[model samples]
Target: MQVTNQPIDAIHEEVFADTTSGIGPELNLINPQPESCRQISAESPVLSNIELAKLKNIPDFEAATIPMLYKVADGGAGLKQALDAIFAAADKYIAEGKCILILSDRGITKDMAAVPALLAGAGMHHHLIKNGTRLRASIIIESAEPREVHHMALLLGYGVSGINPYLAFESLEHMCADGMLDISFEKAAENYISACTHGIAKILSKMGISTVQSYRGAQIFEAIGISSAVIEEYFTGTPSRLEGIGLDEIAKEVAMRHEPAFAEQNIDPFSYESGSHYQWRNGGEQHMLNPETIVKLQQACKTGDYKLFKAFSKQLRGSAFANQNLRSMLTFTP
Candidate 1:
């Protein structure tokens, strides 16, 4: 029921996809007037119209806490632990007859690393599906991992019913404190939720689907660099045209954040590393088009040398940085 898609106006209106079943339109938990951000929470951020009011209801919401620290530094141990916990939570939910499973990565300390919520969520979803427990409980994630529309879409696409972007709300609060936002925190949060829900609706609309329920567990995404084994075991049925990294690579990537956060000697800046995937940096996220690649291409063109051009092309295919894209991994099929 998209009364209005405009951000501010939409917040005032009760515009949500159908949640309640066998209920009349008027009784579908519609909020006509302005309200607080009480609707926003770790569980059912996209409110299901089945409200879980009061803190006492937490007993029904089984929590699966993800840890940051592990026995190994490369984040393999930590990630493995989290994955095991998620799978275990699936079983626990089934055994206990629970309605909701909340996977949270909020156990933050000086010595902890986060298992990527997307990876964790998708893995759990697939695991539960394999074991015939996907519908046992609705998956709700309360974490700082998701902040953008892409994240939310991917989460829902892979089988997440609810998401509470806690960190984003904190950031919005900071912005409001610094006078960056002219509206109240509740209004900012409402606008943010509205934007995310609207963005999700647009994505689904592109797929010619009107409801989020149809998009849920659809796995309508293709992997570029992720390996076949990972897709088969974790992200089953998702297409991967050019398989790339596997578990080891994933662990190393997680370690990139984990190690820094848990390091004995704090990073001098105490900030996340800047990625150079967009523009080249001394030692940053790799990009296919960099100074060396550009220089090689320029030299090859200037001298009209096929060998130089071959070298340039070779660099594009051979170099680790260049292989980040699927195009670099493509080969001629005879």
Candidate 2:
């Protein structure tokens, strides 16, 4: 409701509030060791533990995946330790029929992405039948085709999850940098909604209560740490964001229609790039995209003539823009 009194985080807490019966602490999924799940305080712009934990609980809805963000003091040892901790928690979830998706953060390499995928595939039965199909792992690499990443998700049988708004926004920024308009108006509006939804989801996930509709609505660029004035201004064009409306109101707007718009396909990237580690909002892990196939995303990002940068960003793989050349190209000022 009254978002003025509510800070962005507070509103998110309200929107994404976890109604799922005390899942985190009860599950004890985080590491017991001080190193594992060790709380770190970040300065402005960086998300907090409370906020990161909010997302930690999000994979429960359908087959969801998220990248793991860990801080390591040692050179590569930290990576191994973090993976160990992740697998430990992953082992439990897989044993229990719950599928856990892992995307490694910066410092994680293509090799790392492969390791977890191999482990999860092999242990799918033993760790699952004995426990449940709880853990699954992936590494995000560079690809132009958004579907390349989507297809991988399908192969894993996780259905498609929209980390779309995040990608769309990145794409928008990428377009802006290039001073070229490749996105369409319809796509822009869609991205606006998604960006708003993602922003709200991060806030709710921080508070531990994000839902499908809420997450989708929170991705609006205005919702993610931007000023309220800006958020309201952007939503002016949307039918959903009426004059007196707030996020909770917006959440209600898209809550009922829950299925993904397009059918999942077996799209994989032909020309892919690898990175040591790439990152995204909500601490997403390194992702794979096909720069060569990115043309497929033209339709997805190009919504009519509007070129909704925000929506198009969502269609991109989380790591598609992490490349210096790509990021520079996207953000390049004409």
Candidate 3:
């Protein structure tokens, strides 16, 4: 947990600035429109489609009719049917020379892997090519990132052209509505989407690629805990460094997570996870900010105790707080 000398936020801001300034030919060249931009909202705490559309128009990026394929109710069979239908429709669109396709999981809560599976299946389909040229249509993912951005990158490496982190946008909307965030809904949404785009850019840059198009299906990563069989059947061409679980194991993990909510027979009011962001909660996933450690760090700074500050710094360097934005404010003078 050694903290970088430069703060993560500052690094991100610099990268974002560079991206916007066109410092690199790949930076800020193209920004994809999220599916949420289609919704019209008056009192809602999220940017309406109209506003985002206006922004998109500034860059001359028209929102095209990107067909959405949602997850079906039945298991694999249902998914296959849905994929077939989507591919069929895609063939029609490609024949018409459409430039993009969107796959959405707006109301889907289970079998989230189906989205990537469908994407892989689409990549395998012959209709994606015409006249010995790959169909120019890009596949954008619209329902992702309640899990991990790495997973999103994995999808991108597999064949996904763009990503719209809908869940993260919804979370920002909730935060604004609950007074946890002070910014306007539009700004929050914009900032969050910008951050996500920056992240994607960073991921691409790491692989020495400047553009998202090149990053698509680059397959630069090696999976650690997925089985070879699953990789071969579904996540084809992606290397699995360590052989582990198969698709059944992955589905079992998904089922275990789903069972908790499904078992709740009576509807009850929902509460946000304690320490939802910026802090770690008991029985919850880890976060970068630790309340107790932050308090101690503040105390050390107030008292001007160099020894105490060093101790606190050492402690922080070992915990998740090393990555927290507050780390930028800490300057070590030795």
Q: Which runs in model 1 stand beyond 4 Å of their true positions?
A: 1-74, 262-334
Candidate 1, after superposition: displacement of residue 158 in Å?
Answer: 0.8
For model 2, residues 120-158, the per-residue Cα lDDT tens digits are 222222332244332232212111122222222221222
> Is candidate 2 or 3 superior in lDDT?
3
lDDT of 1: 0.66
How do the predictions measure up, each by TM-score? Answer: 0.69, 0.25, 0.55
As for candidate 3, its clashing pairs are 37-49
Candidate 1 structure quality by residue, lDDT tens digits, 1-334: 3222333222332354432111001111354534322232432235321232232165544434333233335355556776786687568756776646666677665555566788878888898878876655567667787888888889888987777788888888888998999998878888887778777767666665555666777877988878898888778899887777876777788666556666687577636666665598877767778899999899999999999999888887775755586566568998
User: Sorted on lDDT, highest at the top, how do the candidates line up?
Assistant: 1, 3, 2
lDDT score at residue 312, model 1, on the 0-100 scale: 87
- Which run of 10 residues does model 2 get worst, by summed lDDT? 18-27
Predict model 2's lDDT versus the native. Answer: 0.34
Q: By the lDDT metric, which is better: model 1 or model 3?
A: 1
Q: What ranking of all candidate models by TM-score puts the best one first?
A: 1, 3, 2
What's the CA error at residue 184 for candidate 2, in Å? 9.2
Residue 12 miss distance in model 2 (angstroms): 37
